[model samples]
Target: MDQAPPRVQLITSDVRQRAVLAGALLEAGFGVLSGPSLEQADLVVVDGALPPSELAAACAQAHAASLPVLMLATSTEAAREGIAAGADEYAIIPCSRQELELRARLALRHARARAPIVAGDLRIDPARHEATLAGRPLALTPTEFRLLSCLASNAGHVVGWQALLREAWQVEGSQGGRQMVKTSIYRLRRKVQRAAPAAVRILTIRGAGYLLAAGSAPPRPPTCR
Candidate 1:
């Protein structure tokens, strides 16, 4: 049997822009739903021009639902703002219809690729965007969850910096991308330490990339006589 077309929730206050985006997505074989409702939606496309508060709220709601977000921004700066606000990926406004379709498809593809990862005591559930080590939950942001997922998916292997950027941010050759990876990795390390020290380790492979290795469980304390 044929599968149903993916449903997309398009969020933009501008009627004209929403109409245009809806047209492009429909032409690309996607079902479009307007408004803030995320029900039955496979993906979300947001307008960066929305008030910062609105944009952030939209992205947060989508992520909370385990849905992927694609933001349409007016410029690179706006795109960065969208990403910082929790968008999974972005496209500059006034882009070609082809590019828009491609980006929407890419976002859906990435979202579908998320499968649970189990490396030793570390468990990552991409569907729920949750991670835990040694039965303790690790508080992680959306970006951090993506970064950890990428590393754990390739556990024990050196995953290059560019690979992390592409997997986590869905962008390649971005300026300051390396630094962004570094900063997020630092945060992930701290969280891991706090949750279950030595149960998992994200190691830097000097000029190579990062590696996610599951460490031996911590030693148990001696019992009182």
Candidate 2:
């Protein structure tokens, strides 16, 4: 049997933005639903320009329904607010249509992967959009969680930057892909260190890529500096 295209419930107050986004998604082979109800939605895409109260209500409702949300925020602060309001992913407004489509697809992909991932002492629950280290919750944004999940899934192997971008952001050949991966990895490293020092290690393979391995002893300070 042929699978139906994933249905996206897109909500935005601005008619122009809604049309553009819906058209992009439709062109990308996704089914678009603009209705207020989420009865048949496989995912939800929201605009951050909506009044704060309304935005919160929409996200909360989606979260309660176990639907993954992708927010289009007008600014970085708006994006953070959306994430805090239960969105699983976000793209800043004025972004390319390709970026929007890719992010939406990424959210759907993450939502469909319900199995929990275990690497060393780190545990990633995709269905719940959560991760923990040594049983301590790691405060991670949606992007961070996805990045960690990718590295953990490929633990012990050098996961190239391009591969990480494709897995974490669902885009290929994007500009600044390497820098995006680098910045996210740096943040992930810090979070892991704070959560459970020496419990897990994300290693840089220099010229190759990155390796996530079970931690041994913490790295010693430079002997000659």
Candidate 3:
């Protein structure tokens, strides 16, 4: 069967705004969901007009489930509150369709990167944007974690320099280019070594790019006896 479009859960009290956002998202190739169950949602878009208590609770709940929350704020105050409540992204209300769609695309793309990915004894938990090596935590910054997740997800494949730049830095033609990517990779490897004294297996494929070998698997949850 063909894969379903990435689902987005839209939470808002305003019927008109919900309709607008939903229409824009639908046109942008996303499945619009309206409910409390967020398990399958790639992202959550909520009205910025929500009360602070309500917004904070919603953001916290969504984050706990590894879902990225985007908000439509009515003003700068609302936008700041949205961020304080853990919104991953936000736009002041009355945003252009292009802006909303673009933000959704970026949020979903980044959130998908957070999903748990495994390579060798290394486990990358997208939910928390965290990585564990040999069962020990690696102290990776956000950019490093995102870069590592991108590599780990495509284990055994030479992810090109341009691709890494796009995935990690979200840019195509920055001035630093490949050098920027190389520096990040160097820093990431050093961090990985802190958790696993063994040589970090992320390989630099010269001319081709970077690769994480494919001997990894997601961490399996313990079973009841």
Candidate 4:
């Protein structure tokens, strides 16, 4: 199935600004939506002219839904508040439309990277936080689930340890998370082994990182002697 472009919800009281921003986003290959529907929205772009409480509430809602938020802050103070309200990024007014588009593109890149990823026998649904192996559910913790999802997203491709930390645990520039990844991968392997021992395998790459062996049942990380 062909996937649709990531949709952005433009929230602004200024009709003219909203229209202009929406048009720019569409030109940049995004599906534009007006009004706030976090569940339906892949990302949110709101105006700073909006009441502070409302901005906070909207950002909060979008974030809780795992939707990324971008705000149009009119001033430095507003930008700070917007961040506090949960916006991942905000632009001061008079900001170029090109910059706005780029910001949205970057946010969507990270967000979409984590969307549902499927391999042969293993199916991973990030939205539902569930993974199934050949019709059987694999027990996974939230962390374990994310780890598996990251590996599955790059199935058959070697994933570096740092990449796994950033993608799965959201940890960056820290070696501490390495141990967490190791332990989590170990547990995840056990779950997969129990759920569909004949199907999936999480491959450890020694000095490198890990990967999810591709294809269907009998998938296992190859041993290099």
Candidate 5:
């Protein structure tokens, strides 16, 4: 069976920037759709200069339609605003070609990774899209679900802050200029802690990101390995 090229929708008003980005992506083998509309896109990238009203409207529409959104920012302020407006990811201006490609791939990868929360009794079933802690189901927001899923998938490895944001929030370095990812992480941690016991840890790596020990499951399973 033939595979379809990844679909990317770029919503930049700047013709030159759009042309450059679109051309680069197309050259690298992606199905590029450049426009201002958010409908019919697996990934939506919004320009930083988009008016607040327009940004909010587009975000609401995308969220309602369950489409993942990425924002392109020219400044830190713009990036913060984009995150607040509900963009799933954000890329910044003057991004390097390598960074752009990495971010694009990360966004697409995370998009595919998104699934329903399937967690129970310290077990998370990404395949089943279910999550549970202590034999009980958890009511995690989409963001929290992604955050936990990312941690679960990488088990023993320490996930970097930028990497976690990329995977969980789908936001690359472009839109994650300052505390956007941190704020999300804090919220995610708090939510998880609220539902779990103090001993069940979600360790912070200080200058790094987070870690979730695979066998850290409560009531350690005999066959945890």
Candidate 6:
């Protein structure tokens, strides 16, 4: 029997943004440990708009842990400083959710590629821009791949619709103009089902959002236990 992967630890500044980011990662399936205090983090992701003293402190803590640092900077100059201070990566915030997921996975992958492989049947080769289930290729549209990659990276957690839209579509602001997210999820489900076992699932939480089921269970509609 195989064991599940350990969760990713996330540290961020703004509570609202942290909540949204946490939910997104959870829906994608990572056990998230959050703190405004970067000293306690395994992976410190900080706001670039923060004061230099604070950002520098966060970087110091990350360096102490030997943990990778990702910064959400407000400007190019800030990003440069973050790198100079030892951040592994820096990106502008309000980015599409797809970009976020891709970069996050790459960061982890770069860190753990030689550690050991914990992921299961789903194989995402970011470099190839491709994914396969149990060695069988999935016919995923590019958008669907980005969405699935986002969710799969944090497999056991719940991802909200708004975050998904931002990542998958790159549309900005807190607006829900259409319910096309549901449509994309549905299509992703069918594509995965074609090759995955019945036990693996993509569960939906009412009023919360969608997430891939952990382990091999096929996604079930949300249920009350």
Query: For model 4, which pairs clash?
Result: none
The number of clashing residue pairs in each candidate reads 0, 0, 3, 0, 16, 26
Candidates 1 and 4 compared: the better one by lDDT is 1
Say which candidate scores most in lDDT.
1
Give stretches of model 4 more than 4 Å off. 1-3, 113-150, 156-200, 203-225
- Sort all candidates by lDDT, best to worst: 1, 2, 3, 4, 5, 6
- Higher-scoring candidate on TM-score, 4 or 5: 4
Q: Candidate 5: where is the Cα deviation over 4 Å? A: 34-40, 117-225
How well is each residue in 1-225 modelled by candidate 4, as lDDT tens digits?
Answer: 989988988887888887788887888788987545666788888787788888988877777787788888879998898888777777787767688888887766756754667887889877577789998988888888778887887777677777878877786848577787788888889989888777767878777788788654333343211
Ranking by TM-score: 3, 4, 1, 2, 5, 6
Please give, for residues 1-225, the per-residue lDDT of candidate 5 as tens digits.
988887778776788988888877777777787555656577766776889988987778776766777788888889899989987777787887666666677766665656443323356656466677766666777767777787766655567777766776677766543376577767766766776765245666666667665335432221211
What C-alpha lDDT do the candidate models reach, one value each? 0.86, 0.84, 0.80, 0.78, 0.68, 0.67
Q: What residue pairs clash in candidate 3, if any at all? A: 114-126, 119-216, 120-216
- Estimate the lDDT of model 1: 0.86
Measured on C-alpha atoms, candidate 5 has an lDDT of 0.68
For model 1, where is the 10-residue window of minimal lDDT? 216-225
* RMSD to true structure for each model, in Å: 11.1, 10.9, 7.6, 6.4, 11.5, 13.0
TM-scores for all candidates? 0.55, 0.52, 0.68, 0.59, 0.51, 0.45
Residue 38, candidate 1: Cα error in Å is 0.5
Candidate 1 segments whose C-alpha is farther than 4 A from its true place: 115-123, 126-225
lDDT of 6 at 140: 83
Best-fitting candidate, scored by TM-score: 3
Regions of model 6 farther than 4 Å from truth: 1-118, 173-178, 216-225
